[model samples]
Target: MKFCLALLSLFFAVVVADHGDHSDYVVKTGEDLARYRDQCVAKLSIPADLVEKYKKWEYPDDEKSRCYLKCVLESFGLFDDAKGFDVHKVHHQLGGGDVDHSNELHGKIENCAKEGDAAGEDACTRAYRGALCFFKENLALVKQNVASK
Candidate 1:
């Protein structure tokens, strides 16, 4: 119950904090998203390659859905610790515990992947995908969590 309440509060906070409410910026279709890609590059001066990242920032194409979800979330934002208020940590803190519990046995594999020591970073990366999946599968839950608080 407490966990649920905490989650509710979190969702509302995110909603409130994101005042830009860039609802108008949504990429509803392949072509629509393509335009946004152009806008993002022209407006923000972000590189074309960087914009391409948005497309790749998605759930896995041929792997575990959960794994893909983690990958997507990881790419949502450009996390630079040098910049203040690292939102990346918030996402990580929120979703990692569940992944940790569900896939604990394979924990070392993930940990190694994170540090570039894992046999294959290509195969084991999950933080981003996990977050993306979490948001997609639980958008309502997140909104509720933020609102409650």
Candidate 2:
């Protein structure tokens, strides 16, 4: 009986440990981004059809997709209510103090934001557009960074 109880306690501990908090969702590398993409879709309750479209690089331009992007960005600490796209946080989180790479990426994102009317849209909409732009334009650099790791 004592052995069974000990085994049950260990199982419960392992289960609790595996259930990581929100920070676990943050994507810091290419592999992490890939994993979190599916997790974010499920967590945000994005529809299956939309997920399929997004996987095919087709922007649905819909609210559910927008919300999923927002949730993913928020998990990465890239988006905030008071300061949209917290560049410093993103730099620290994704670049690991590589100021030069961070600056370059930041400039690219800034340029992308400039060509848009994100201010007129809701938070989710803006995040979706920004994330799409970033991924489309800067995925190479991000993947390179992951490779270097």
Candidate 3:
């Protein structure tokens, strides 16, 4: 009976750990992180005043990038707790490296959900909008490889 209890506890721990990892994320290459992020950007424009501020963050860093992004995703009511963060803020903030912004958007949304506020919402939305404009103005056309279903 003790052995069975131990196994059960281990199983629960593993499950919780898995969920925790999924709660935060990173976007690799050739993934939808870029695509969805673009779609969001296409919809919203990052605030002009915040553009330089965003330009200061490190590219692809998970936490700060996620905070700015959460504002956009959750505002649209598309915040995903798992497997759904797509952040464009990282792109503009990080000097527009060859990174994927779409995947990061979901995380931004998650952060916003955690800390609910009109200020956060406004900031995120402006970030998203500004990031989008920055990207569209600066980069080549996004290859619509697989159209969204």
Candidate 4:
């Protein structure tokens, strides 16, 4: 009986750890972005070619690429039709709850999104636009984080 109870406890612990909230997967640096990209690709079943295109920030020219962007954006909690982009969620995820840093990044992203021609675009177009804007705006940070890692 004790052995069975111990096994049950172990199982519960594993379950809880694996199914924790998205907060557990904060993206504070380039390494974190890479990991998030990997997770998104795996979870969304994005094709290798599409993944490559995404890495280059190329606009999605095919359905698979578009779907890949959609999956990635949704996973990052940066997607919203009515609100355009969830800057706060993105800031929290990438800044690791650093309000000042997140706010600064958020402002950059907001400006980029506004300047981009995402209005009236299709789902894929919008996702690609938003992603392009984000990557472009944070290229320096991405490079710095990746280099440090």
| Alpha-carbon deviation at 118 in model 4, angstroms | 3.2
Most TM-score-accurate candidate: 2
Q: Best-fitting candidate, measured by lDDT?
A: 2
Q: What C-alpha lDDT values do all the predictions have?
A: 0.39, 0.66, 0.41, 0.64
Count the clashes in each prediction.
25, 0, 23, 0
Model 1: per-residue Cα lDDT over 59-134, one tens digit each? 3343343333333222333222123122323333333322232344334333422443223334224344334434
| Residue 23 CA displacement from its true place in model 2, Å | 16
* Residue 30 displacement in candidate 4 (angstroms): 7.6
Instruction: Report residue 132 deviation for candidate 1 (angstroms).
Output: 4.0
lDDT of 2 at 22: 24
lDDT (tens digit, per residue) of candidate 3 on 32-136: 444544453445454444434444422242334444465444443334334233333233223223444355543453353333333434444444444444344
Better of 1 and 2 by lDDT: 2
Q: Which stretches of candidate 4 lie over 4 Å from their true place?
A: 1-45, 55-60, 101-104, 115-117, 143-149
Stronger candidate by lDDT (3 vs 4): 4
**lDDT by residue for model 2 (15-47), tens:** 777443222434377566567778888887877
Poorly placed runs, candidate 3 (over 4 Å): 2-27, 46-68, 71-149
Q: Candidate 1: misplaced stretches above 4 Å?
A: 1-27, 58-149
